[model samples]
Target chain A: MNPTKPTDDARKGDVVSPTKDKGWFYTDTVKDHFFHPRNFMQDESAYGEAAMGMVGSPACGDAMKIWIKVDPATGRISDMKWKTFGCGSAIASTSMMSVMVTENGGMTLEDARKLRPQNIMERLGGLPARKVHCSVLGDKALRAAINDWYRRAGQHDNIEIEQGRVIDATLKITDKDIEEAVLDGADTLEKVQAKTKVGTGDPSCIPEVENLIRFYKEKYFGAE
Target chain B: MRDIYLDNAATTALEPRVLDAMLPYFTERPANPSSFHSMGLRAKEAVAAARGTVAGILNSREDEVLFTSGGTESDNLAVVGIPRAYVAKGRHVITSAIEHPAVLEPLLHLQKKSEIELTVLPVDRFGMVDPAAVVAALRPETVFVSIMYANNEIGTIQPIAEIGKEILKWRKEHATPLPYFHSDACQASGACPLDVEKLHVDAMSVNGSKIYGPKGVGILYLRRGVALDPLVRGGGQERGIRAGTENVPGIVGLATALSLARQEMEKENARLIALRDRLIAGLLAIPKTRLNGHPTVRLPNNVNISFLDIEGEAAVLYLDAEGIYVSTGSACASTSLDPSHVILATGLSYEGAHGSLRFTLGKHTTADDIERVIAVMPGVVQKLRVMSPVNLDMKYFA
Candidate 1:
């Protein structure tokens, strides 16, 4: 859990007290990017391809809004910027993501889209094992941003969709909605229904919804 | 390094005077209080004196102050032990939604075991259970009620005495002695008036650590008739309710610390309240920030605020860098990323719960410390808000 180097943590006289056990939260690299985030998209009125890449429920703790400016002829991400309503690691991870793509003469859209959470974690030294799950939203959001850039350029073939099987025909709620609801602490079918209105408009999806709830509950939370 | 501690509700730095009181027991008197020899008697005398101190403060008998490991243990013994002891009377228990996990978890475990029926009463937007509502929730089968005197996260001081008085009235009217009231006064120990008589509680828990005492020491003030089934069994200690060799040094420390707290509570509370209000005023001045608990009917030492449009851990981290220490109810601070149940119970949304920061004042806190926090807090909040993608709105909160 403590990925912070011993020498860093043992710098006992630093502002961050050794007794504070901050080393357990994130590595110094992560904290650096967190405290001083880079490429934060303060004004994103133009980046309208939104809500595709996010860390948490809007009702909960984390969310991210990412935008990109890609050069079509050069096939390069000329700029990348993001804003996150997230934890330190989430902000740091997003900041690091922007830097990764746009720093030292930017990476191409082709290279940027290939980025994974592991790559971001590696570059950020590493997030805590716990933070690795919820806080590492940068790579996923970056891929979504790249996809958005492709959409803006009208290159329909370039888009990579995170497809979800539609569950509720009337409400257009999908299996992904069920999964998200479960992640937001909707463990049972009734709670999922309450949150997503699943199996309500179309009672035909009721059995499938129950099964999916069971599956997702087991998937995210394990056999509880 | 500049070090400022504002997380006293989590735990306080041990008072030197407390350590001074315990030094002899820790170093010279190594015998267990259970032993019968001279050295054992010395340890026994220290333990008994601690008990006497606790009893005197709570207005309970000396024999009633049963020392345990800490607040968690004291709470567990009351919530878990009392219910099981009076199982034959009936098997229903009551508690608030915002109780510490120590009380809630054990009662939930008992419920899960099919041993007791449980009712969790909800709190208002102020994170206070209406005294009338609590009285209304009581049932004939209710063997116990464990409500915290002050919430850990929000620091809303409960109307424990009012609730206790209501319970007593109900018991007399119904001619039933089934329900025994217990208040977890771990957070309330130092600041609040904790006379068990005035509180009308059958049992109350007070911990050492929160009062600048040694950690790993707490006492359950069980009124004479209130029985408790043992949680830990060994040498038949604590009159068989809590069984372990007595912690002599820790006990002495707790007693010394608690005496100091009681002695200086009035003056300290005045100072802390002023500091706390100044902190609340300063933090709430920041845009989109709101106070979490009740403004006036809260603990004097506590100031909880929800800095909207930003994550709590981020705010906490930034504050840490500025030589300020505080706690947050944010999910990011937890291993499971679960938002605080206490803050959530106040009818704040998950977002608000995630952003809630609690700063608890203590003996060491000063006016300058309050001003320092006030000076630094807005900048931290503004920095995070500028970085956060979420739009500012109190609409998400009801």
Candidate 2:
């Protein structure tokens, strides 16, 4: 049971209210999954014959990997588990995703592949807006895992690679290029341009290029 | 459930003695010091005495101490006002990267407006600013230098007196008093030495809340003949440096708290150092754990450590569940989605900064509390680490 907290003065992280015991910024369902994550994979080596999906990075704030075993006889998920190096929101999101994909004799692989971050948010009573971007990278992680499952399951036709948003329409530089540039130690717009030639042809997309650099830096390097 | 408070660096609860001294001024003799009545005279007298108390601790004149709303305003006044008042001399300013945002943000805003050319000096791995580096950054146009007496995140004490001596010698060589030296001593007020003359700082900012006094009250000590443009423009109060109706109660509480702190400084510092070391040693015993700030040069009550593989927000929340309160430098814990600037400035990897936790001892902290933390923290870290996907090398950046 949760300790009753006064909701009158709840700021984004106002856990220490004036008149009550400490309260969490997250909902009770979110805290439950964070503290007691369902089907958490403590050691991956023991899980045996599962496809894994990973996103973000362990070096940064939010990163996670999910593993699932498909029941070949029924065409449903037999086991679902995850490991994460993220905040309360990210862990809860992934935990809820694992639960949703496998509960009640498991959902079919086609159904699990269609799951989105919004569905996870709705199930956990909606995540904080600030967390929606970083924490829900779990949705990307899950999609990667399902794609891996398709390859591992010999359903090669079902594997779908992500085509990230295009920032430079002229050079056809996608946002993934920007992320790779940041991971390769390119922090500034000029450095990213030097590496990827992003926005070289379409100078008008400079602003968008700058925004993507900042986003990738925060997502991959935790830079302000 | 066990309850313990360890986040003293963020803010402290008011001392009962401080609250006792402030009670009468609030409900009993409530009158503006500006009014020409007997009650007003008493209020004025109280404010003057509080000024004297703050000045006495800093070894400065009562006239030099200007009271304000709190540390932020005091910092704003010193960081912004000092350069502006001396702008005719030059338009250059210097500060350290590890300085509190109260000092850093204002200087940044000034630079953004092209009001001044700013140079942000870097710090060492232990978050110590180099005095020589500071001196090297100074130019003929340098109008001001601001650095904190102690850092809020890591509790690292800057070599302010050494830097002060360098600055004084530089001024002598250059034959110019263009660069005014300022220090934000809010976190340093009660724990460290704040004698302005010994430190050779032209100005210093001290806060009430950080010293176990009432919040919303602070003082800016401007050395004699040091001119600063006023920040708050109203009523020409505080010698025109800061203006507004004085917070008589908060001010009185601040003075009392500082005096109490001064009286007990030696004994309290000794007690806290013993407990702090015990906490640090216990935490470092964990595999892949590292301390954040300087080993011995930090505040007596501060203990900051990074637990690898697990994020700081998760640690803080899990500790909170066990009724042990603390704070962290992780981006996950921040609304801005960035880790602590102080931690980053110390050259910590993103993983290290995200995993950093700060536990500050205070008047209420005890040996049992430290023991409880040592006991609870290991299990918490193990739980989080087992669930985490990370296998950090401790040196990897991304």
- Per model, kept true contacts as a fraction are 0.68, 0.63
After superposition, candidate 1 runs with Cα above 4 Å error? A1-24, A45-57, A163-224
Interface RMSD per candidate: 5.4, 6.2
| lDDT tens readout by residue for model 1, B165-234 | 9999999999988699999999899888888889999999899798889998898889998888888998
lDDT of 1 by residue, A135-183 (tens): 4345656766777677777888989764478776544456866776677
Residue pairs whose backbone atoms clash in candidate 2: none
Q: What local lDDT does model 2 show for residue A137?
A: 61
Q: Which DockQ-derived CAPRI band holds candidate 2? A: acceptable
Give lDDT tens digits, candidate 2, residues A85-122: 87777788888988898889999877876665557767
Interface RMSD of 1: 5.4
What shift in Å separates residue A196 of candidate 1 from its native position after superposition? 18
TM-score for chain B of each model, two decimals: 0.98, 0.98
True contacts kept of 1: 0.68
